[model samples]
Target: MPSSWLAALEDEASKVLPAVFFEYFRQGSGDSVASTDAAAAWDRYRLVPRVLNDVRDVDLTGSFLGTPASLPIGVAPTTLQRAADPAGEAAMARACAGSGVPMVLSSNASTPFAEVAATGVRWWLQAYLPEERLLAVPMLEAAVASGAGAIVLTVDTPVVAAKRDGDGPSALTQVPPEWLRVNLGDAADAPKARDLGVRDIAWLRELTGLPVVVKGVLHPEDALRAADAGAAAVWVSNHGGRQLARAASTAGCLPGVVEALGGAVEVYVDGGVRDPMSALSALALGADGIFLGRSPLFALSVGGEDGVRRLFSEYADGLTEALRLAGSADVGDVRGLEVREF
Candidate 1:
C-alpha cells in the first residue's frame, strides 16, 4: 500500500499464486475486521526516542527459548507453506538457517521434520493436541528426534474457525492431502482437543522433554496461568485473527502479558508486526522476542528462499537503524524504552 518492497512483494505474490491460495494466506475469519485492524494497532504507540546517548553500532542479536539467535525476529508457523512455493517449509528452514534465526515449523507442514532439520536452522515444532492426546505423540516424538529445540503448543485453535467463503474453492482443497500433514501421517484427520487447559503445558514438557511455549495467549491472566503451569514462555497471538473474529491485536496484548509474567518467563508476540518500529515497540514493552507470520509467507511466495532471506535482511537493517535512532546500542537497551499511546 505504501510503495515499500514488502508491499510490492505482496502484490507480486498475489498475481503469481492461485487466488484461493493467496486468499488463504491473507484472509481472516468472519468479516475480517480483526486482521484488517491488526497492523494499524501498532501505530497507536508513539515511540519516545532518547537523546544524547551513544547511538552508533546497534546490535540486533538475541535469543529465543535460551537458544542464541542472530536477530530478535523469528518466523511464526504458518500452515501449508507449500501453497506459497514448491519448496515450502524446507526453503524457509534453509533461509532461517543461513540467517542464524529460529523458525517454528507448522504441525501441518507440507514437508517432513527431517528435511527441515537437515537445513540446520534452530527450530521449534508447533502442534495442536488432538482430542486423543496420544494422537499427537508420534508426531511430536519424531520432531524432537529430528532436532526440534522446543515445542510451541498452539492453544487457540481448538476448532478451526469458519473463514468467509472465497470466490472459488478453498486453498486446502487444491492441496493434496499428503502435502498438508506430512508430520501426522495417518492421524492427520484427528480433531484438536477442545478441552485444552494449563495442564497440557506440563504434559507436553513431559512428552517431549523440551521447553513448552504456550502460543495464542492474549489475556494477562492466561499468560500467568501458563507460567505457573511450567510454560517456558507465553506467546501473545490471536492466531493472526484466524481463530476468532474481532480479537485484540498482539501489539495491544503484549505489554499486559509481559507485565503479568513479571520476568518469570519469556514473552513473545506475533501478528501485525510488519516493520522495525513495531518490533522495537514490542521490545520496549518487555517482549523477549518478536515473530512474523504473513510477511514471511508473502516473501516466500515472491522469491522462494532468497525472498525470505532478503526480507529478514531488510528487517535487520531497519531494526538496527531504529535502535540507533532510539539511542539504544542493543536489543536489551530497548527493554524499557519509553512509549506513549497517541
Candidate 2:
C-alpha cells in the first residue's frame, strides 16, 4: 500500500494530472492559512493513552446516519471527478461500495446521478442551491430516484471568495462539454451562491423524506439552528479553507460546535484531516465521522478505482492501529478518550 495519501498518491497524481488541474486541487484561498493550519491544529493535541485496556482486536466498523459503515471515514463531495479518470464518479462509487463505505457525490459531478448510483453503493447527494428553484428541484428528484439515502445541503458558499487565488479560469470551464455539464444537464444550473438560513434547511427536510445534513457550519449557533431546522446531521467544515482564507480550522472549532449541539444531531467534520491519527483525534474530540476531500481524488487520479480502494483499506488499517495504541477496543471506545493540548 502507499505510505500516505499525501506523500505518495497525491504527489504521483501531480505528475499524472494536468498542471492546471493539479493546481486547482493544490491551491487554497488567500494565503492558504486555514487549509495549511487544519492538520497543524490536530498536531497541537496530545493523546494520553490508557494502559491495560485490552485493545488486541480493534474494531473500525460503525454506523453512519443509521447505515452500516466498515470505517468511520467517508469520501467528501468534490467536483469534476472525470478529470481524474474517464470513469469519473462511477469509479468512485464502485470503490466505496467494495470498501463498505458511503460516498457523498458532488452536485457538480460530471457523471449523471443514475450512473453512479447504479453501482449499488450506499450514497448521499451533496447539493448547492442554484439561483433558479426549478434547477434545484429536478436535481433533488433525480438524486432520490437514483437511490440517494441522504441530502447534504451546503450552506457556506453564499458568494465567491474575494481572496481566492488561482491562475487562469477554472479548469472546470475548460473541461469537455460532457465533462463540464453537471449531472443536472446544461440548463444553466451553475449555483449562484446566495444566503440560506435555518428556514431553508427546514424547507429541505419537508421537501425530502431522506435525511438532510447541513454542511459548512463553523459556528455552534449555526449548528444549533440546523438542529432546530430538522437537520439530521451537521457537517462542520470551513470548505477545506477554500471558502474563507483565515477561518478557524475545523479541528480547533469542533469541540465548541459539538458542545453547542450537545448531541442534538450527529456531527461530522472535514478540513486538513488526511491520515488515521488525525481521524482518531477528531473522533475523540466529538466528530461522529471524518471526511477526506482532496486525498480521494488524488487517489483516483493516480490509480483510478483500485487506488481509491487501496486508500480506504489503508485508512481503516491505520485507524485500527491508532485505536489499539491508544488502548481503545473499538470505534465507540474512542469517544471520551483522554486527549489534551501539546
Candidate 3:
C-alpha cells in the first residue's frame, strides 16, 4: 500500500477521473459549506487523555445490529462508485469483507446487488422509498434475494437536490450505462420519489423479515420515534450535506440522538468523518458506529480495492494509537474517554 494520506489520494483521483465524476465526489451541495464544515467541526472538540492507565492491547472489534466487525467503522453508501473505478461497489465489498467490517450498499450503486453480494461481505441495503408501493416492493425483493442482512431506508432525499455547476453534465456523460441501473428492473416501472414518514418504517418492517434501520435522522425525538416505529437502528446523518445546504453537522447532532434513544436501539452516524481521530471522538460521544463516505470513494479512485483496504488499514492503526493515548482498551472503553468542546 502506498504511504499516502487521504488528501493526496483525492489529488491523485482528480488527475485521473473526468471532470464530472471528479466534481461529484469532490463538491457537496450549495457552496459545500455543510459538507466542508462537517469535517472541520471535528477539530472543535479536544481530547484530554488520561495517563498511566495501562492502555496495553487496545481492541478495535465491535458489532453493529448484531453483526461483528473488525473495527467500529462501516463504509457509508455512495453512488456511482464505478465512476471511481470499474470494479465500483464490488471492490468496496471485497475490501470491507477482507477487513471484517460492514458496508451499506447504496440503492444507486453501479453494480447490481447480487454481484456485490457474491463477495460474501456482511452488508445492509440502503433504499430510497418510492411513492409507488409497486416500485418499492420490488426493490426490497431484490435486496432480500441478494441476502442483505438489513435494510436501511434513507428518509432524506424526497427529490434530488440542486447540484453545483458541472456536476450534472459530467456525471451524465462519464457514468457508465450499467451504473445507472440499480438492479431493480425496468426504468419505465420505477415509481415517483416521495417523503418518508414513521408509518413507512412500520410498513417496511412488516414486508421483510430483515431488520429495518432508519437513516438520515438528526433529531432526538425522530430517533426515538424510529425506535418506537419498529426500527432496529437509527442512523444519524445529514446526507453528507448533499441534500440541504447549511444543515447541522452529523457530529453536532449525534449526542442528542444518542441521548434520546438511550440505548433502545443501536445508533450510527456519518458525515465528514475523514480519519481515525474524528471516528474515535464520535465513539466517545456515544455513537455505536461511524461511517466514512467521501474518503473511501477517494481511496477507490486512487487504487481500487487495494486503495480501499489501505485506507481501512491506516484507520485501524491510527485508532489503536488513539485508544492507547485516550486510555481505552477497546470499543466499550471509548465512551469513557475525556472529550471537551470549545
Candidate 4:
C-alpha cells in the first residue's frame, strides 16, 4: 500500500472500468443523464467555510446503526471491486480497518462474506432482493454467521433499469463471460425487487440481531415508511447516479427525511459525494453520517489497496479540515450552525 497507489488506480480506471461498467452498470436516458449531472453537479458544489475559532481537536468518529466507525466517512459499496484487484473486498476491507472506517459489503461482491469478515473491518452486508425467497434466506443467514454488524437492505430497484440499447430485454450477452460466474446459491439472475418494503425486512432484523439500515430512500414519506417497518437507519441515496437519472441530490433530500424519521432512526446520505465539503454539507444539513461509494472504486481501479487507502485518507483529512474551519470540533459540532442556502 504505497502512498502513491491512488494515482495509479485512477490511471487504470480511465482505461478499463469506464468502458466495461458503462455497459454493465449504466442505464440509458435519465440514467445516462444522471451520470453527466453527477460530474457537473459535484463540480459546482463548494463548501462555505468558517474561520477564527479555537479548533485544536477535530474528532470525526461516529456510529451508524450502533457500529462505531473511526471517522464520519465510510465506503459506500459499488460492484466489481475484483475487477480492480485480486484481493478485491479484502483489500478494501483492510484499507477501512487501517483508516478506522466502516465498509458496506455488497451482495454483488466477488469476495465471500467470511473472507471479508476476517479482515477485522466493520462488515456491513448489502443484499439485492433475490427473486426467490429460498435464495434470499441463506444469504441473510450468512450475514449473521459471518459477523456482519448491520444489514443494509437496499430498496431502489424493482427491475434492473435497462441500458437504452436493449430496452429491458436480456443484455446479458453484453456482459463479458470472463466477468461472470460467481454466486450465493443462484445469485445469478438475482431478483429485482418485486415489491420491496419494511415488512419484508422485519424478519431479517429479527434474524440477524444486527441493525437493519434501509438504503435508497428519497422521499420523506418513504423514510417514515421505513422507520415504521423497523429499520434502524435510513440511507438517502440515488445509487451513485447510476440507478436513476435526474434524481434529486441525496444531500438535497435529507432534511425532509430527518423530519420524517424524527428522532427514532439514524439517517445517512450518499450520491454525488465527491469530496469532504459535500460530505460536510450533508452532515450539517441533517445526515448523521455519509457514505463514500464511487470514489474508492475510482481509487481502486487506479492503484489497488493503496489507492483506496489514499482516497479514504484524503477524505478523512479533508473532513477534519472542514470541521476545524467550520468552528466545529466534531461531526456533532456542525449541527448547531445555521445553514445559509442560496
Give the per-residue lDDT of model 4 (tens digit) for 1-342: 122443244455667654555344434334476655653443443445566877898878877766677777778876677766677789999888888888998877778788888998887888776666566777778778988888898888776654455444333454444344343556656656677667777877777777888998989998898899888898988776666666676756777898787768989987767667777777777788888776787777666788788887777788787788778887877766556555
- Better model by TM-score, 1 or 3? 1
Please report, in order, the local distance difference test score of every candidate based on alpha carbons: 0.89, 0.84, 0.85, 0.73
Q: Which one wins on TM-score?
A: 1
Model 1 quality (TM-score): 0.97
Model 1: per-residue Cα lDDT over 147-190, one tens digit each: 99999999999899999757788888888988987899655988
The residue pairs found clashing in candidate 4 are: 8-302, 9-302, 9-303, 10-302, 131-191
Better of 1 and 2 by TM-score: 1
For candidate 4, report its TM-score. Answer: 0.87
Against the hidden reference, what TM-scores do the models get?
0.97, 0.95, 0.95, 0.87
Question: Could you tell me how far off, in angstroms, the CA of residue 331 lies in candidate 3 after the best superposition?
Answer: 1.7
Arranged by lDDT, best first:
1, 3, 2, 4
**lDDT-better candidate, 2 vs 3:** 3
243-272, model 2: which lDDT tens digit per residue?
888999898899999899888889999988
Candidate 3 ranges beyond 4 A from true positions: 1-4, 186-192
Q: Model 2: clashing residue pairs?
A: none
Which 10-residue window of candidate 1 scores lowest in summed lDDT? 1-10
